[model samples]
Target: MALAHILIVEDDAEISGPLERFLRINGLATTAIASAEDAASVLASDEIDLVLLDLMLPGEDGLALCRRLSAANGPRIIMLTALSEPTDRVVGLELGADDYICKPFDLRELLARIRAVLRRPLPAQGRPRQTEAAYRFSGFAFFPQRRFLRSPAGLRVPLTGAEADLLLAFCQHPREVLSRDTLISLTRGEGFAIAVRSVDILVSRLRRKLANDDLAAEIIRTVRSDGYVFQPRVLAE
Candidate 1:
């Protein structure tokens, strides 16, 4: 399973705070929001897996947000509220909610529902939208899913996980010099200990891969005394 990030859109502090903590403790990332407006902003800027929404929210209600979010291929929505009325559940379902659970619900059951919803197919939508998809640049495409590079002629080139990881960092921050320390922190945790020279070596291997057919000069450039910069503007596909 992918690293799941949950967006909690509940007005109640008592509900949102503990729910966020609990989900985080169970190895999931979370963003807590109190209003539908903030939730919309988060959805646009971040990749969310499932949204845990409270029906009775301040300002625009959860049903409204669910309709707006679910109109296209988007994250899975699971409505949460104290309202157990049949009509409320029906309306929420009609608005494209994947599941609905009454508030004051058990955490275990809630987690199970989240996992179930993530496991099922999103109908014709295929996989949930991810922030890191294929990064295309200078007639080369890098697919993180299969850890392979596609040449301009559509030839498959293999990539090591380490190479792919560093390539992703460069793609994310193109045309900017990234210090060796910064690249280490982006690819590995803060605690990981590797010399700065090793980072240069890794960059060399990846540089050779991008230098396919002897065009590596246009792919990555080294800024003397600084770090490296991805010379191409990447297009995500």
Candidate 2:
């Protein structure tokens, strides 16, 4: 079997150099790049499995790169940020990054996060066949079995695997207020471990995509301090 190919997108040689060596030593194929431009080139020409992206880079910033990746059927992304950058982390998650680790992060913890993300299923990648029908709401069509969303404008709206999971949950229970913890459980199940805050971020990301068209207004609505409600009455087709 081919080893997992990881792309390390950090401008800091001090960090990327050691990270590359460490991941390679742990039986992963590692490629290190300095800029988001070079990282985009590598991603275009390489079959990378995951990306360890840094927010600060020369020229194009990591958040912009992450947004581009979110729109593409691309590899998973995990951001690397400073310890004081909580806002960046939330923004990264809103941009569809799979995970992130604070700078000065423990190598072991980062490695563990990498392993966890690698093990998680990607959207529409070899999933088992399902009898569930496609969902139609607000002129948008979501085929859960295929793991893709089609807009009313007949364009394919890009969605991360995590976003797909969360959308599935909302479709399954439309008009119901789904709390953060309930959403985490519904999307990931009991064994799936993720922070409740992640659920909120993912909802924000999904809402952004769902509201891509001005005609499709208020598909999802926040329920004050409770959770959130999927407003449109979804119908299974």
Cα lDDT listed for each candidate: 0.78, 0.81
C-alpha-based local distance difference test score of model 1: 0.78
**Model 1 worst lDDT window (10 residues):** 120-129
* Cα lDDT tens digits for candidate 2, 25-126: 888899999998998789878878899999889999999998888777578898998744667677787787878888888787788778777765555544
Candidate 1: pairs in clash: none
Ten residues in sequence with the least summed lDDT for candidate 2: 121-130
Candidate 2 residue runs with Cα over 4 Å from true position: 123-139, 143-147, 152-155, 171-179, 185-195, 208-237
Q: How many backbone clashes does candidate 2 have?
A: 0
Q: Which stretches of candidate 1 lie over 4 Å from their true place?
A: 122-237
Give TM per candidate: 0.52, 0.72
lDDT of 1 by residue, 82-164 (tens): 99886677677656676678979889778877776565433223456565468898888886654567988888765544566
The whole-model C-alpha lDDT of candidate 2 against the native structure comes to 0.81
